[model samples]
Target: MFKVKVYVTLRESVLDPQGNAVKGSLNSLSYTEVQDVRIGKYMELILEKSDREVEETVKEMCEKLLVNTVIEDYRYEIEEVVAQ
Candidate 1:
């Protein structure tokens, strides 16, 4: 078995309104030390062993559905699971 962890975030050139809102709220709460805030998405998926390469499958999934390539960037980690 394999476990995949995917992280998606706004592209560096993209404006993150949600993150900015959070930062504003934090500052209003007197958390002035925060210089910026960037919001992101994390997901986990499990798959049985397959003939396909895990990384390639994950990349295709991300590019096709999980991420908006024009505005977002993504990365993934794969871990092998040993069934007990």
Candidate 2:
């Protein structure tokens, strides 16, 4: 079995209003040293053993649905699961 982890984040050039809001709230709570905050997403997918290449399949999934390539960037890692 294989497990895939996906991370999606806004592109550096894009503004992240949600992150800004959280940062503002943190500062109001006395976290004044917080310089900046960037929010992103994390996802886990479990894949059954197959002849297909994991890298290619994950790439297709990310580009087609999991990420907005125009305004966001994504990266992933795959790990083998040992069944008991």
Which one is best on lDDT? Answer: 2
Worst 10 residues of 1 by lDDT: 47-56
Candidate 1 residue-wise lDDT at 67: 96
User: Local distance difference test, per candidate?
Assistant: 0.92, 0.92
For candidate 2, which ten residues in a row score worst on lDDT?
A: 46-55
**TM-score, every prediction:** 0.93, 0.92
Residue pairs with backbone atoms closer than 3 Å in model 2 (clashes): none
Candidate 2: stretches off by over 4 Å:
49-52
User: Where does candidate 1 stray beyond 4 Å?
Assistant: none
Q: Residue-wise lDDT of candidate 1 within 49-74, one digit each (tens)?
A: 67368888889899999999999999
Per-residue alpha-carbon lDDT of model 2 for 1-84, expressed as tens digits?
889999999999999999999999999999999989999999999877563788888999999999999999999999998766
